[model samples]
Target chain A: MTAADHAGWEVVIGLEVHAQLATTSKIFSGASTAYGAEPNTQACLVDLGYPGVLPVLNREVVQMATLFGLAVNASVARRSVFARKNYFYPDLPKGYQISQLELPIVEHGEMLISDADGNDKRIGITRAHLEEDAGKSIHEGLDDSSGIDLNRAGTPLLEIVSEPDLRSAKEAVAYLRKIHTIVRYLGISDGNMQEGSFRCDANVSVRPRGQQELGTRAEIKNLNSFRFIEKAINYEVERQIDLLQDGGTVVQETRLYDSDKDQTRSMRSKEEANDYRYFPDPDLLPVEISDEYVEAARATLPELPEAKLQRFVAEHGLKKDDAVILTASRALADYFEAVAGAVDATAQVAANWVIGDLSAVLNRDGKDIGDSNISPAALAGLVNRIHDNTISGKIAKQIFEAMWDGEGSADEIIEAKGLKQITDSSAIEAVIDKVIADYPEQVAEYRAGKDKLIGFFVGKVMQETKGQANPGQVNQILKAKL
Target chain B: MSLDKVKVQHIAMLARLKLADEEYASSVEKLSRIVDFVDQLSQADTSDVRPMAHPLDAAQRLRPDAVTETVERDRYQQNAAAVSDGLYLVPKVIE
Candidate 1:
């Protein structure tokens, strides 16, 4: 809910995001961690929790987690233990899910998010711990029984828990987006919400504005998209507020958001609220990370979003807003840098064309920057034509459309279409002379101090030359002649 | 430490065990005695000692990130009592 809807109450929200680590195999087994496969094909004996099988930690998982911790400036625990959280579910072939309880890998991490007020706010990360994901249960297409697919069992996940610091659904989304950007920048996770690689569960509560204690919190789970996360948290906040105002107390339980109905309904809570007796796993010893390991991971950390944004502004001389937009994705930022670096024009021109026109076409075609039809070099070529006045900026749009349609380079398009700007002083002066003769009334109005009619004369000159005349030269000539 | 019949019944339910009504009394007695026996260790004053999870004083060994397992779904499913399309079927647990 919006902060204004709180109605003399304070909204306390914390988010727990589970990101699937980009690993080649399961955390404790050698089984493949590929997303789609035949049912139960990827699950190994250790993944299935077979008897007498012991788990060995994956080095890459720990290294990836360490990289994330370093990226967020969190402390990498010298030693962390894996524990068993006992529960019973059909998908869990093992009676317990191995998770971290007291000692997690990373803690006290914070990230800056532009709050609802669009100011820098640092949200504290309570902890990020390593855990194994559970298998999937397919209830559909079965007449009376649910089928279990263990293919996703024992996948490595880093569950990041945030402090109860959020005040609005919008702020919560900002925090989530910041985390997504960080993980993708770190290259530890793909951050693909569609494949359940990154998912969020929001713990939302509200209390009187001046109250020190928190209200009973309801945990909303399985929100995959940013839109659903915002809507679900807002819906939950409104529900809790309405309940408390009606003299009903809020209950602490897990909720699933019904996107179709745009409402949240309580799932069975008794079994979930039952005690999960956590005990350290006896089979595996405590994991101990070395300072050398952390240092090595730190060295591999590429320039993160903040550093990239600053570099784009300082080195490329782009505006802060454009830098932020380009730095949202690593590939997009790289694309911008490539264009900016290769163009004969100012980087700001590259930024404008990339952010304004190129992004519009990409969004309309439902294509990612990676799948763009126009390569960065080709785009730079197009920008170069406008920069050197080989083509007017207006004609550049036409050249860009041709380039997107695979009509060769800008020079080739200009040659084939005869779309060169009329930069020769004689040619432009001739067009301006013709336009002045054609639009005498506008010329008279312009000389009579209707200076805005200069646009009318300029348009006529552009029409006479088929939009090839240099706009600045035409403006100067028209103003002097009038 | 003591475990009552209700507590034992709750534990049975948590573990998904079907306990007969008469079995609760014996389970509580045995469980309480076991807890009491373990509780005797609490009498020692070792608050300064670090909690140990495993007996071995070794760190967890890490395996390299590599997929060595191949498709053994046919051999694995042979142990299942019922399966359709390589999935383990269980009674529907509708909420």
Candidate 2:
């Protein structure tokens, strides 16, 4: 059920996202941070915590964190502490994780997310702290044993926490997507959910519509996809509402979403909460950020998504929805800008084709904007042909298909397939005359005030010319002749 | 801040330690003492003092973003108690 379905209840959600930073080396070690290497290969002595080993803070992580802070208009703490959160699992070799506590790096930020009604809503950011990631535990391929891969043991991650301002699952997803776009635009993280670069944990609770006290919450962990995050939050909200309606109080716990079952199951309870015994790490020093460093990082920031979307609408004369789609990704926005620059006067038409046809093909093929085989200039050439009356939109689509199949450029495909529109006025008139003469009955009806018969004559003329006749010219000439 | 026997057992469980029944009492006492010592430091009035996270007030030293390490899968796996196909194998992990 949607949030609206529960009439008198408010579903409150807060998201804690762990975005892996795009760094070449591990956060505390000189080990390669490349994904999908052989197991245990990237774990250095420091990562493995061999006796007498120490962790040196990575400077790139701090810069990227500061860049993200500026992107969200957060305060970049001049002095932030790295504390050790003590926990134990096979994946964590050091028996504790180095993270920020007491004083985090970035705090008190806000991000704007659009609600389902397309109205902007601001969500408060609590804090964004840098931490080291745990290793991977492989449970497959072993009948009675599991394997540990420490390749990811010391990777750097920025844990961005959001306030409980999201009212529904849709709002939560919109907020998450906004964060995803920001990180990608900043070039700090690849934002690859499938590869575990970006992941979220949702804290969900429901209270009476006007209740001031918050209800008990359950944290659903490790949601990697947008679809799963939506479904899991919806399901969890429904579960809590049902329990409360049945006179049962909600229990605070940690849950894991089973995507296959489409339900959440309890992983652990609050009674099992780790003390964490957080304390400052003795080895690493405080991360001090100078005003000069903050300015430099801020200078490196790219034009964000909202500004780009507004520019696309204002400068390119695109509709709001069209601009939103065009600026969904930085690469796509760049591609649209290139096409618009090449096809100057008809930038709106270029926006239509890019957002409509190009997006449809990319979605169908499960490809990204960067994966398109059609270059920006090639699409510009096709749009220019349509604009200059060299080819009809229908034939342009065929040329696009051929271009997608690697046939050749738009000009080459149009020439080789003889698909150019017949702009010769006399030739089009000849086809229209023959079409009218061949259908005298329809023409007589057309003269009897049956203006709809003009459609029949146009279809016949188009068919006679093998769909290459200019449609606008055919309509004008067909009208004058009758 | 003092850790009870039950609290000590819970901590041990979270840490995945298989503490023996005879060890819980001594472990609780030792952990309680450590917690009390840390708690004593918090009793002083330091409202004017800033919470310090590191000993030295130095900025982090940065290295260039480059892959400078070589893979030594076999050599690294040599320290594992059990291994198969270059992976460190242990007891089965259920989810």
Candidate 3:
């Protein structure tokens, strides 16, 4: 084994991401693969291992996996074999998890990741394989053994393995975000991190920056949020770095992230390859997918997020940063384009409102655009109101908040709240004239070369108008008046 | 295959399994066979093959940022073997 301190340390990050495929049925059995079902109620005989029960592949799951492979430009293995990943667990009724091992269904794709510096890098895709999720073990009951919720048992999961090419926590987060975007764009996984539809295990270790030897890595499991991921990896990295600095050796183990302490604690010393005791699952036959099936799934592929982002930047004249922020979520992108198309305004402006005001309100309310009371048409209407000077940007923010709270249309909110922009030159001129009259000393200071105090006069005028006045008109009118 | 017996035993120990001595011989055989199968995978002309990450082509989905509900801590801790002030108790080391 190569020692971690032999050279400069390189942080090699490979993510084992488990995505719950958005299929209506379980992968192997015909049980309803719905979330939030009562415990054990959804477990069918096939899933529960009754005698002579045969495992059948869900066509929808295979199609969804194939669609993902196509979207990422991965090789869909025409033939893939299912194998039993053997381990004893109370939650896994089937003695072993029915997962693809020797022959994964999807192989060798590249995920394009963009950094905060506007640089796009291609991360190597290792393989994506189909598997059935283990039932959740609820250790919250009076029984000595945990209560098993088999609702998640046999639920379809696609395990995406990535190459250990990432060097830092930020890169890992960017890669995760890119993966998130691709999966949502393909419409295969809902990517709900909190509900456990999408989860990640980050393999983190610190070596010298150019070291060939990998450090004894710890696997941080079941991190669902991007914030947690970045925080977890960063904390783990520092912990590892501190250990090395203190002359302590890092152990190979599986660790859990304590959200409270913001530290990683070892669950167990990590299992090696031999511990799984994997073998071909004889109960299921080798999946023989034909060219036609692959073709059909490929044909249904939508414009993936990467391609759409590129189009937005190149065709619609949006900035790369703007395209990225807009295309972070498909619904957000769709809302933006609908509004952008409706208002015929700058894409940057639409992008700004979506990422800034819209996202801020959604974040505050703990909602996405899909759950937000703001519809695309209403949002488009609001944007139009801003574009036409009917409501200033300042008033439009208020209108948006009202719209989000299920209030009336943008026009109605403006009327009811008396929020129309004070664009009338005479009215704005009068307000500016009064402000000039009231703050004559400030006006004299502005004329006496304190140019920065002009903002003070503009603030007073906007305050006098109850923030309904157009800022540009206020600035323009104030400049002429001053 | 017999030479892999020690490696199998180490792996079993790492996984916290209490295998009988008799089971070790069979586990070595089984693990050897499986390792051989995995060895064959490296030769399947995958020089051009990419390792698969996720089984699907779609981006990872996200739920609305809203907190669904809060877990009642007292109810959640009711099943613990030992609890003190809403915390699970494990055996402490040292004074």
Candidate 4:
């Protein structure tokens, strides 16, 4: 949609994200929560909703939720109830989904998202509640009937709801991204959108500038990617504005974003709107978290992304952008810390190698930092070489590539390939004398006040040494010779 | 307060139950009595008390996060009306 389309209207957006908690077992059952198993094999009697089977909540789920609550600076509920949301579908083996209604586990949370102006904007979180995921329904394969796989039916999820604080699609993306980073950093969830482990639905509406009341909202459902979230919200905003301009009122409904079409179409209208008669589940009692439990969970939290980013900036003097990229994942952050700590005097140099060359190699192979062929210590060895002038930065790149190819450590590669920088003054002077003799005209030019000719001499000596001479020593010696 | 015909119909629709026109009279009376009884229960003043979610005051017992259940798909799928490749088959539902 064009900016002119929403010129006079203010877009209001809130997100509802469903993150599957990474646990060994399902939330209420002993069924394994591992993905990609044979259909219905991991589903047990409790997950299949067999009659008279009771649900016993997992202790680790609460601990993880407490960790998340503390990470977001939120209050952990002392008592939270599990309510049953009544619905009927083949995918829902149980007639209703077990969820939280009036009392959620975490509430009044907020996170800071970098606004478009590059300022920290605090987005208010309404609540994050615990819920159970439904099963998968396959429709195409069977002739007359659909197939139901209850494997994912009882998996635990945290449904995080945000306030209507976002003003633009960019801000929505930023807010969603912050949530994704927080959940992954907390180690509570894998936050894999492609695997449907982390998914979101957007509630979007628009109003004329200066109008207090909000326009009728049409919810865009099941947006799994950041780009789609922005695109779907923008499309929905333009649609509502166009409808309003045409003297037609917007209808409140649930819409699906067709990525193929890049548009959100209504899934269900208000007439078919959901009426989930939520009541406390009688099978399970209330979950009460004690102060001691919260303290223990707090102890388990490592430095969060924001804290680590600030530490990188304040302690290591890294650029904010570089720090952000380095701390995007826990493994990457740890990798950077080790590399930087090894080369204590020059962390920016360490940052450059990790964020630049090592990242390029990892990206080229489509591998994560945890899966990089070059270990952090080996990369640190390479970085230290460049700092100590054992190998010039130019030669270090060559050694880096060799190390990525499993050619051994940086020092080993230097020895095997003979790519060490020539730092000995005697050896450098010999190359400089040869350059001065070979280019007496240029030396005479240097004497005649063409200072630019120094570059020419430096290029030659570097070429003579096959680009292995210490550049600083080359410059110092070449000036003395002329 | 009594549940009227329209309210009863909406409740039935939400429950996915289709009621005939003749069945609405008795259904409204039965459902109205249920609502009225709940309304009577609401007359007690519990404003100072905490909202009770369960009848028992005991906290929910937690099990350790360990996979203790094994796959018994063949045994469970025996009661299915139809089965295909170890999947329970029902009327085609798409949304």
* Stretches of candidate 3 exceeding 4 Å from the true structure: A1-7, A115-118, A239-250, A269-273, A421-482, B1-95
Residue-wise lDDT of candidate 1 within A1-482, one digit each (tens)? 56566778888999999999999999999999999898999988888878999888999989988988888889999899999999888888989999999899999898888886679998999999999999999998999999999999999999999999898899999999989999998888999999999999999998988999899999998999999999998898899998998899998898999999988889887654459989999988999988888888888999999999999999999889999999999989999989999999899999999998899898998999999889999999899988888998889998888887789998999999999988898888887888788878887888888988878888888888999999999888888878
What fraction of native interface contacts does model 4 preserve?
0.91
lDDT of 2 at A195: 98
lDDT of 3 by residue, A210-320 (tens): 667888888999999999999999888888887897899998888899999998898855346346777777666666778997998888998888788899998778888
Chain B, model 1, TM-score against the native?
0.92
- For model 2, state the Cα shift of residue A43 in Å: 1.8
Candidate 3 local Cα displacement, residue B69, angstroms: 30
Ten-residue stretch with the least lDDT total in model 1 chain A: A1-10
Candidate 4 local lDDT, A116-188, one digit each (tens):
8899999999999999999999988677789999999999999999999998899999888888888998889
Worst 10 residues of 2 chain A by lDDT: A268-277
lDDT against the true structure, each candidate = 0.90, 0.89, 0.79, 0.90
lDDT of model 1, residue A460 = 85
What TM-score do all the candidates reach, one by one? 0.96, 0.95, 0.77, 0.96
Worst 10-residue lDDT window for candidate 2 chain B reads: B59-68
Pairing residues by index, what is the TM-score of model 3?
A: 0.77
**Chain A TM-score from candidate 1:** 0.95
Give the number of the best model, judged by DockQ.
1
State the lDDT of candidate 2 residue by residue for A209-235, as single tens digits: 999999999999999999999999999
In the order shown, the candidates' DockQ scores are 0.88, 0.62, 0.05, 0.85
